[model samples]
Target: MASKKKRVKLKSLSQGRPPTLKPLHSLSSKATRTLISSHHTLQKLRAKAVAEGDEAKADAIAKEIEERGGIEKYQHASLLGQSSDRGGDSSRILMDWLVPIVPALKQHASDGRQMRMLEIGALSTTNACSNSRLFEMERIDLNSQAAGIKQQDFMTRPLPNDTKDKFDIISLSLVLNYVPDAIGRGEMLLRTLEFLKIPHHLDSGCQEIFPSLYLVLPAPCITNSRYLDESKLEMIMDSLGYIMVKKKLSNKLVYYLWRRVSFSTKRTCFKKVEIRSGKDRNNFSIVLK
Candidate 1:
């Protein structure tokens, strides 16, 4: 038999093409090694700082590392581009939504005065309270020990009846999620509005206390064990005579802007309230008279 023909296989390089690329795993292994080495270097630097008793320098280095990844990632994305005086982009976005409502609130306020605002769970200290020109901001929080922000216990005690007619705007930001139970959360909502004097006595004539409210919550709000669903929260607000005027959803949070449609209007002297409850509901009429 004739000698078997020699078999040949063309290599990629031999075909005048570059060799096929390796898988990402192969490529990334080297990169990962380098990153680990860099981390070790940073650790060494920190160790040196401590050994030399340069506590400030050590702290600075540690802070840099923290900023690179730690809790910084959880910081508000809109705050990424911001300065101290001007407030963060997140605050700006909130303000943009709030500006239109200002005039409406001002109209309802006594003597067309600037509206007072209350910000709950304002952990960052950069909420509407920072914007002096836009609102007279007051702050409240259940967590008195949280760093970097002021706190007040608006839940346990209602806002004084005398002051109920003072605030024109109220904000509940990322707070309802932390309330431990549904009954407590519902009570918190009622107490919060009560402090603002929402259900003004009809005999008193719309005293114009807290005409608007802005609530920023996680859209579904069910991811965290402490959080209540948005629907239930909305139902609670409806029961209190607040109407949702604007709703916005994003990857980060859901914002609802609410306004009082009308005060209690009833021929009877009884304080009967009618609030919008279902998804199809459009208007709420409260009879506080």
Candidate 2:
């Protein structure tokens, strides 16, 4: 019998909201080993608790499992079964999620400006395009279980104080699923906006776009959630002043690309927009007014 994978939705949020998420706590290495070994028993206990009408007990068990960096985190740990190098491979699934923006990366390299990338919930695995020659990647995970990964809580952390130290790309691959609800997911997106590097200055001839977000999630999350699909996602993000550049749905996962549009460009956004599929990319491109 096959086990079911969890479903998660990608939320669109306004920048004004605040994240009230709880802290993520990682178990010690020994504790993690014990947890992994006792996973079945824990599940059984959780099930019994649920059956006994002890909702509080069930929730506590579930939160403990999640905070200890559950199955997903174990699969990503540096010292675990799979090596992180495999995750760094460019041939991995959806490797070209950044393909359309390769030209921009090349241009930045030519200008001696390295594109900065932030990978949230990267755990011990390499982030999407971490192997790319285009950017210098920095990772943050709620758990310090993995060495060399910074400990940062994305839900509540304030934006960096230095203006010159913003990232050009932020990847939240498979991370938003951890959020509990639509509002929490929306709040996470709101927090994400602070780290984006949008250009304040706009030229009449051509407005320069800023940092873009790369989001990947379980395919079901997109299909099942009313507000998280390609069309609705673009609409939601548009309201928040970002334009959806591309969206792709693969067999196991979904991908989204969003470029930060300037305030001036946003003024013209809702006028007349068209969604047309890309010729060979199997994704849709949005033409904003």
Candidate 3:
């Protein structure tokens, strides 16, 4: 009789051995984007597998992630892209837009209190807005890389109770795309409102400055997604009472400044129905529940 085949068991994501991290340096722009995008895709697949209770598939994905050098390596690659030599700081463009449109940000506020900014998913303390004297910034990230950045999940942060706890502006650069699912992305967007200062009456330019969101996303999310486009994004923001103040689209990224126009309680249901169809379009979407 043939010997019985030995069974092979796989470890779950938590039980899997940690990946061997290698030092990442000088990652080209294309390579950095590829790594980030690949990680996102794998994460989405793993989320689906876990949700469907496919233990074996989840474990396989976990192994694949390990082989790819895990989250630490992915983050290191991202840091390379953000280096000054790459001109990868999204806030530089944000500063350019603000100086001409909202001159108040170029100088200290009249009350002697600098504008408060909450930078979610902050990777560096040396970025344009962080270095500027115009804003007192509180930077938070899921994985803090340095001393000043607090390691915190934005989703779990406590809601601001009073005006002092709120912020004048919130930056979510390249963050929404990192959310593993569509509904979570929408929730993150809604949560930004809870931490923002109340819409105060002021000059048009100044009003546009405070209680705003400086959003940066990969250009393909808007241009190549089957369920999202510029119009769709605008509609979603409008439902949340935010009006677009400025928008700039580049080859690889898209930037938007949205100011809260009103505290509208009206809700809009945006499902993940495909709004556009084309060959090679991505499935990126935001679902408002």
Writing each residue's lDDT as its tens digit, candidate 1 over 78-162 gives 1232344323334455577656555554454445455567776554555444653556666654433246545455564444657
Which window of ten consecutive residues has the lowest lDDT sum in model 3? 9-18
Off by over 4 Å in 2: 1-55, 58-60, 63-107, 124-128, 200-210, 226-228, 263-289
**Candidate 1 — which pairs collide?**
159-195, 264-286, 264-287, 264-288
In every candidate, how many clashes are there?
4, 0, 0
Where is the poorest 10-residue window by lDDT in model 1? 12-21
Q: Between the candidate structures 1 and 2, which one is better when assessed by TM-score?
A: 2
RMSD of each: 21.9, 11.3, 5.7
TM-scores vs. true structure, each candidate: 0.49, 0.59, 0.87
Error of 3 at 96 (Å): 0.5
Q: What local distance difference test score does each model get?
A: 0.47, 0.54, 0.79
Give one digit per residue, the lDDT tens place, for model 3 in 1-289. 8444333322222222223355465577888778877877887777666655676777889789878877667778777877777657889888887776445655446566568999998888998897766788899977677788997888878888799999989999988887767877888898888998879876557775668999999899999999999999999999888999889998988999999888876779999989889889998999887
Model 3 pairs in collision = none
lDDT of 2 by residue, 1-289 (tens): 9444343322221111121223234445565445434543454455445445566766787776666555454433323422343233212333465565567667767888767778776655453456566777778866554676786677756668875667776788766654433445555665666787765542231133346777776575556543344666667576666787667676656777777775332322332122332333222122223
Name the lDDT value of residue 235 in candidate 2.
71
Q: Which scores better on TM-score, 1 or 3?
A: 3
